[model samples]
Target: KKNMVKTGKAALLLWCQKRTEGYKGVQVTNFTKSWKDGLAFAALYHSFYPDEIPFNSLSSKSSAEILEMCFACGLRHGIPRLLDVEDIVEMPSPEPFSMMTYLSQCYHTMEGGQKGRSGLASIQVNESQQRQQPA
Candidate 1:
């Protein structure tokens, strides 16, 4: 999870360097510094909000835009997504979203379409939900 966030930040930093610095007609040193600063900012953000692994759909958007969004959210008592617990602990945990979760979603849906289960519920519904009380 951390790795994913780090990688995404690195990618965003590179994108920022390629776009803003090149467009501003800034000096090479200044451009280079901005690029490096962007990277530093990204690294700092990931270090803190390392869990909000770039939402797949968000990643589909422009990297610069995504970076901007993250930067915005990082401030102002943002979502503490790292811990995966929105309630208990105050500080956010640095855990990324599970890729397997999305993969499983796609896998199940694809498989479901192929095999039309002759039932309504995807999982067993009438099964025991609690421990049996013994006499």
Candidate 2:
């Protein structure tokens, strides 16, 4: 069981690394320390939505600000807020489980469509209406 958990974590980490590859100033080695600066999250988000998030503009922001932006964007796009910016910023190394859970959610959410420079196809979301559309 422990090994299974480790394997799952490893796979998630590898997925993150692959998605964020070639992103300048972003290196995802582990879920804890490597994410403290929030650049990893930014890179991952940018990978899915490059035009929405200008990669170069992130460098000037503080860790807290960067985290806020990432979380805000995720929230806007229907990704749940599994981790808090305050909790992440205050700790030297965040708890890996929470990070992994959030990242997995991100992966599944962003993996649904063809990706281009402009990002995924238009999504129609109506807050007042709850209707399912067939694929």
Candidate 3:
């Protein structure tokens, strides 16, 4: 099960990298000191907010408009968290999400799609009402 989960994450990250070609503001190469980390960051944000990252969908958009959207995404969530947690000088270090909990949450929600399952995503949410049982 662990191996399967890792494989799924790897596949997702690869797909994320491919999708980032449309982003002009952050040149995937020059934008981040670590390419893999940068790509993974972009992918996670993209997965959570697909509508925010449009491809050739907006032909009428000016360069400045596209840049604003990309910048908003890059600075808004995971990236800032990543910077706060990791030593930025070290490229490709594993820092998970800026808030590590979100990574697991995202994986749980999206992992179903990786197994040829259509939109049946699972969420590992812990309700406050459900208290832990003492052993």
Candidate 4:
């Protein structure tokens, strides 16, 4: 269950990078080759499928234990530059932007956020103010 999130995230980032970033929505030349290579990871990442299987060995483990193992397996390591994995890997902070949110924020949004960080959300000069004149 936990690993599925990791799988989806990697696939999603790879999806985003291949589909959204530098290539301009086009698949890279080696995409199919990489996808084919990805299939061989089915055992360690086997839980990443729509299908389910019981693991007698893991039945006794806690979810945290399973998640720890997933991290150790490097299941969630390859991250887009938007997410600072080191900053987030520790734990809960007052951040509205969690790791997933950070991932989704992407390049353009980061630029916008940096602008907003200076504190003005958006200052819309009203028509009346526009009409009043620029002094």
| Candidate number with greatest TM-score | 2
Candidate 2 TM-score, C-alpha based: 0.78
**lDDT per residue, candidate 3, 1-135, as tens digits?**
986555445443434444455564333332233332333344445656677766435456553444345446655543332333234324354344432333333443445435624221111112212445454
C-alpha lDDT of residue 67 in model 2: 89
Tens-digit lDDT track for model 2 on 48-72? 8877677788768899999898888
User: What is candidate 4's CA lDDT for residue 20?
Assistant: 31
Candidate lDDT (C-alpha), each: 0.33, 0.77, 0.41, 0.34
Q: Is candidate 1 or candidate 2 better by lDDT?
A: 2
Backbone clashes, each candidate: 1, 0, 0, 0
Candidate 1's residue-wise lDDT over 33-94, tens digit each? 33222232333334334565234334355434544554454433332222122211122321
Give candidate 3 regions above 4 Å deviation.
22-33, 36-86, 90-135
Model 2 spans > 4 angstroms off: 113-135
Error of 2 at 42 (Å): 0.6
Error of 2 at 37 (Å): 0.7
Off by over 4 Å in 4: 1-44, 47-56, 75-135
lDDT sort, best first: 2, 3, 4, 1
Stretches of model 1 off by over 4 angstroms after superposition: 1-33, 36-40, 53-63, 78-135
If both were scored by lDDT, which would come out higher, candidate 2 or candidate 3?
2
Better of 2 and 3 by TM-score: 2
TM-score preference between candidates 1 and 3, better one: 3
Residue pairs in candidate 2 whose N, alpha carbon or C atoms collide under 3 angstroms: none
